[model samples]
Target: MDNPMKSSFWMLCILIDLWPYVEDNLTQLQCNLFSIGPGEYFRSLVAQQKTHLWTQRNLCDSPNDAHDRYISNHLFAQLVDRHCIDDRGPIKLFCDDFRPQNIIVDPTTLGIKAVLDLEFTTAMPSQFASEPPWWLSLAGPDSYLVRGLTLDHFVEAYMYEPRLDQFLAAMEQAEKTHPAAEHHKPLSRLMRESWRSKRFWFNYAARKPFDIDDIFNDCLKDGNASIESLDEETRAGLDAFVEAKMKQLKAYDTDCARHLESAG
Candidate 1:
């Protein structure tokens, strides 16, 4: 990271070579020669991996509402997987932990020092990379503490538009100068459209499984998708599943309490 040629600027230069190829079948074939898999294959592979990971976790991962967490994970994982059916891939490296504090800066000169925390980086769906970052040094809609804000009132309650407009204007200016952005649509335009189309919500909810139930219903869902209003297909046997799941969590909680007592 200290090397001038190995900075974030050069890391992003990979896109300059990739954009002209993403939408052109002939160019994509040329890219495959360099070991960049086609968009469709990469998307499908990531989707399968995500689905398997989702199934492996359940109420145990989130104990607050075990039954709801277990069911929502399965149901929403289906919707999240559907996002992968498109040709919009050749995945891009993304970092969910990207935020202000992670980027160290020289306060006197107002220059970035180094980008830390590369551990969270992964090859993710293209949209996840293009959509505007959710961590804008503010309480994102997902982490809002106001009553009712965590429900469908999320986006509206965040009071996001004024800041978003300012960010987009700056982004539009930056995109005009970025070499990689020339072949692709302006990232600012894509981000505004991503927000408008709610693809941003899908991309966000797809990553945060612990908060998926609230985020999916509040932002991603079209209408009532709660356990009570789920379609018959997803609703079937849910009642019994909830009952069995609650029992498991009860045992889990009891074991934790017993261990705490022993430790004392």
Candidate 2:
């Protein structure tokens, strides 16, 4: 296993490889970024994650009403997708789970032997590569939603600002220590900009659908998170969507129960 603290450097190395495709006309020494084509991928994943959420009966946290959450998710999806919508983005290979567990190492020398879990590894907009990794602080994007809590409820307790500063600081050190190229702009600078610009949160939610609401409530916009915030037509459509999803989940659960009974 790798310590997230030490492994932060390892991730910086990976990000260097995640750099965008540079053309011969390289003029900027900065981490120029890109995003998903039109951002449909994220909106779609929100639907997918919602289906999984209800199907698995994972509604343990009651910090907010489920219907309100659906509305929050729906509203946020519209806002969040914009973050990932750059058509000119260069696609680069990346693995979302580029963290400690997938890294295998030799105990004696502590050298990495292999990296596993490549199923979801694929090309993405290079701006995503600039996203500050979640594991660097060991505070996953799953923090609020998975626990039935909002980030507002637990963020201060975690001293998130300080930990985040430390992570970025470490990333900067790693960048200086390893020069992928002298002309390249600093990756650490790009990462901090990601945080400040909310690109980190949007890209995070894009890849992790379940955390969309958490990020929306905490990062993109705050309080007064009500269905009233949405337009009438949009609200009506979501009501219908939720109604349809409920029936679909019911059917899925029934099928699963039947399969279990038949096996018994």
Candidate 3:
């Protein structure tokens, strides 16, 4: 129970056990409670997130902010297109605030007895679940940056933890036993690639609004060559879209400030 590695592995196993149930029942639950299809849901969610980020002033103030915004919007559009074309996998069901504080664990056995918060739990695109959970750090990704540690450094430290190999082995065995093992196998691979390519930041950013600026900056640094390789028309479109969005956001913020001033 005192062993952190054992505790983490057990938590991972719990997640593995819960995933299939969530995936299998998602459609039925959606039908019973709401009627929107997953594709439409994804589009709406992405659009809303984009709008929310656009309106936040401090998120895009870095030196490479323009390029970062351009890359983020373009990558998001591509992600949307890809998911729209083949939105066949099971949607990810996760709690937004998945942290140790919310988990009730047995001190003697290091087993999770109950998960407390169900309010923030929801389904998202399977790709969102492809990467490792952010809760591993017990803090937001920005906290690492504030401590002068890169995301890669954080990941490296996590990987070096004891019994990580055993944890991964258990995960692999669990995946093999699942009915949709083939579909789930890609997530394991994607998780590794995400870490290596710094794409984990993008996945992280997708879920957390405040982390977008830092993630976007990291992505731009890591994928600069790939971004540059994009076709001229595509790049131009991305530039125009981001420019317009920024203008709209600034106007909205200004209007809000003026209204507050008048009221005051």
TM-score of each: 0.65, 0.62, 0.56
Per-residue error (Å), model 2, residue 7:
35
Better of 1 and 3 by TM-score: 1
Ranking by lDDT: 2, 1, 3
lDDT of 3 by residue, 205-236 (tens): 66665555556556534344457656688677
Off by over 4 Å in 3: 1-46, 57-59, 62-64, 79-86, 146-148, 157-166, 173-199, 219-264
lDDT of 1 by residue, 100-191 (tens): 77899899998999999989997665777778777653655556634445543344555566668888899878866783434567778778
Clashing pairs in 3: none
Residues 1-264, candidate 2: write the lDDT tens digits. 877754664455334322432221132212222323434445445555555444433232332345666776766656644576465556778888887888999999999999999887877777777777777545575765678766654446566667778877887788778855766568878777787887777787667655666677677764665677888876777655556556655554565556546645
lDDT of 1 at 62: 41
Which stretches of model 2 miss by more than 4 angstroms? 1-66, 104-114, 143-160, 174-185, 245-264
> For each candidate, C-alpha RMSD in Å?
12.7, 12.4, 12.0
Name every residue pair that clashes in candidate 1.
Answer: none
